[model samples]
Target: MADVVRPSDRFRQGMATRRRVLGDAHVDRASGSATPFDQPFQEMITEGAWGTVWSRPGISPRERSMITIALLAALGHDEEVAMHVRATVNTGASREDITEALMHVAVYAGVPAANRAFKIAKHVFDRIDAGETGGGSHD
Candidate 1:
């Protein structure tokens, strides 16, 4: 069985990391939608992914961000990829790092996935360049 995280600790840590990475507005919106049905899943992710894995000592956040981007891109999870792209800055993953990861994804995952990931990344980067809170563009 996986080591379960305490609910209180998970919520606190997850909310903190989420706010740091995704910004307060995004975390607020997500928190606002918490319902009985989805709350458990949210907690699980908060504890397991955000608190446990992300907070682990094995790898730097930048490396984790790179791995996350690659996995999300390869899986064609556009929304998640976009979210992580926004997290790159907070994780200390430069635009160049993201570009390199996507290029590797292009070779291993497929050009289509890489292309779509690039487009999403570009959109996020553009938003950043435009002084928007969570958007950025590569091109």
Candidate 2:
């Protein structure tokens, strides 16, 4: 039999923050798809990344969004970069902000990484423009 774990206070906060940033639809899909093997991993990120880091007050969500995109690009995490790019609609990071972050990534992380990230960002931007992503573009 499987054991049910009660959510911690931090986990609940993280879930709220995650939903705010990623949207209810995305969160629902992810939660619905979680299997036993990956459930623990999901919980960990919810509590650690969203609850702890993202919930902190030092930086705004917009700044965190830019930093997340840049770091994902630098690490060549293509899917994550695209996901975060789409997330900008909620984070309030404008297209210009993402572009500037990528520019920095080019100089600091490497041109190749930045170039790939740009392509991914552009695709996400196109979707945003088409009104397929729900949230309006920040421009």
Candidate 3:
């Protein structure tokens, strides 16, 4: 049998990690916006995804950022792509790296997805250049 993790403990740990990777302001907004109906869903993300997968040491944040960018672009997760692009500063993935990754998305995920991703990324980059960046992650 596998050991179980307490939900409270996982939530605490996940929030810390999420704040570190995604930035405090973004985490705060998400946390603040949680309603009763959505609280459980929020806990799932805070504990499961952010706490478990993102906390694993198998991959560096930079690598995770690149992979995340590619997946988001490939899946047409437009809002999430912009958020992760803003998070590039923390992940150490440069705009060039994102561009290169998007090229791969074009080849494998279809050009329309990549085209939209590029457009979304451009909006994100423009915000970064203008110091108008927003949330950390939408997913």
Q: Evaluate all candidate structures by whole-model CA lDDT and list the values in order.
A: 0.81, 0.89, 0.84
- Model 3 earns a TM-score of 0.89
* Candidate 1: regions farther than 4 A off: 1-6, 134-139
What lDDT does candidate 2 reach at residue 67?
Answer: 98
Flag regions of model 3 displaced more than 4 Å.
1-7, 135-138
> Which model scores highest in TM-score?
2
Write model 3 residue lDDT over 1-139, tens digit each, in one string. 9999556877888888888878888888887888988888889998998888788889888888889889998998888888888888888898898889999999999999999999988888887789885664445
Residue by residue across 1-139, what tens digits does model 1's lDDT show? 9998555876678667767766776767676777988878777777777777777787888988999999999999888898889888788999999999999999999999999999999998888888877432110
- Least accurate stretch of 10 residues (summed lDDT) in model 3? 130-139
Clashes of 1: 12
TM-score of each: 0.85, 0.92, 0.89
Report the lDDT of model 1 for residue 132: 79
Model 3, residue 106: what's the lDDT?
93
lDDT of model 2 at position 24: 84
